[model samples]
Target: MTDHSYEFTRAITRRPGQSITRGLRAVDTGAPDLDLMLAHHADYVATLREAGATVTELPPLEDFPDALFVEDTALCLPEGAVLMRPGAPSRLGEVAHMAPVLRDLYADVRVIEGPGFIEGGDILTTGREVLVGRSARTDAAGVAELATILKDWGRPLREVATPPGVLHFKTDCSLLDGETVLSTERLAASGCFEGYRVILTADGEEAAANAIRFNRFVLMAAGFPATAERLRRAGYEVREIGNSECAKLDGGMSCLSLRL
Candidate 1:
């Protein structure tokens, strides 16, 4: 898999903890219901398997409320995995919890040392180059460190600013294919994705920007009918999944797992 094209064969995910309601969120979206969240997670796992991934569902971590959103802890690459230094102190321990597991799966697992902060949510792979979003969650120092760590891959690191009000870059955009990205009008206008084709989400369907391109399907949040229809018309096999609970906490489809 190049930066943009990911034919994921395996995935690593963690179930939401019972304390998930206490997880951090920029908005006070209502607290998540544990049972409902679990059901959603189960369906997410099913979706991944349907898209050809061998899923490894880790047991829920009771101590970490936001542990279910595991993608923020690390990034899986074709060459190796980079364990990120989370921006939130409450989330820092998550990397420690995930490192051993990643070490077992990846021959080489690199770490991002602080006073820098980085999160997988701020990173976007475009096959030829890696787009690192310098948002409040990810800083220039973190980007520089990641660039150094990824130098062996020889892909230029493209830096982009996260659009205002977006918690992460992918919260408003995701790569649909090697050359095309599905984004909200706000993100498309940001000019962060220069040199690539940007497909604006259907009006009022900004949440669709966070959709994921699983092996053979575009997995997106449910309830965005217009956006879903647009993707279908674009020749994608889009699968709509319920994510109301996660949405309440600012979590999106791509935040739930580490796909590689």
Candidate 2:
């Protein structure tokens, strides 16, 4: 039988380093508050634990400022894990640092090699199909490599060109459920989600588009009351968590953990 997709029962997260304030961001949202980010990180881990997932916490990488965004380092699959080669050259070390950890937990761990750049945030699997985005962070080479790796899984693949304005495909959209997507208007109009049910976030709540559907509840970014209400109306048990600190560093709920 085919394994259930997005069925993550364990999660791995990292503590924030003092230099986390120097993390990468498209815009100068200003430096993030290390304390607030740490506090928020604790809450994030708590949420995962509350959902019955065993949480593995990694120490802060004092050298990698963006190491807190652990998901970029790898993509956890039912069969194994794909250690990524981050788009930013500076972030490549993250994969190296995470590989050993993954090898300890998974027997079939693989990686994307040179000349191909891929970040976990650019790939979205909805249990039905895999939607890979061609963005600044994930090129055709990267997508092709991923397709090759996923061939054994036998899922339909769609290579969608990410909207120009977004940092990553998921920066503008997220898989809310097997067939439901929460996306920004620009990404929603890209027609990449034509067959799925799309729920657009409220005006100015674009960042709210990035969310994670954990074992039970949906962990959404705080400050988007309208979007939160819309999700609640849809019958999803939504949990709002403050994201202001992570936002300054260009992170969302999805980027904070490697769910497996």
Which ten-residue region of model 2 has the weakest summed lDDT? 1-10
lDDT of 1 by residue, 11-103 (tens): 888998878889888888688888998898899999999998999999988888888899999989878999999888888999999999999
On residues 1-260, what C-alpha lDDT tens digit does candidate 2 reach at each position?
A: 33345456789999999888778989896889888888888999999999878999999998999998998888788777888889987798888889998999998897887578899988788868888888888888888888787786676678998888687888888877788999999998878898899999999999999998886779989999999999999888899998899998779999999988
Q: Give candidate 2 regions above 4 Å deviation.
A: 1-3
What's the lDDT for all of these models? 0.88, 0.86
The alpha-carbon lDDT assigned to residue 65 of candidate 2 equals 96
Q: Name the weakest run of 10 consecutive residues (lDDT summed) in model 1.
A: 1-10
Top model by lDDT, which number? 1
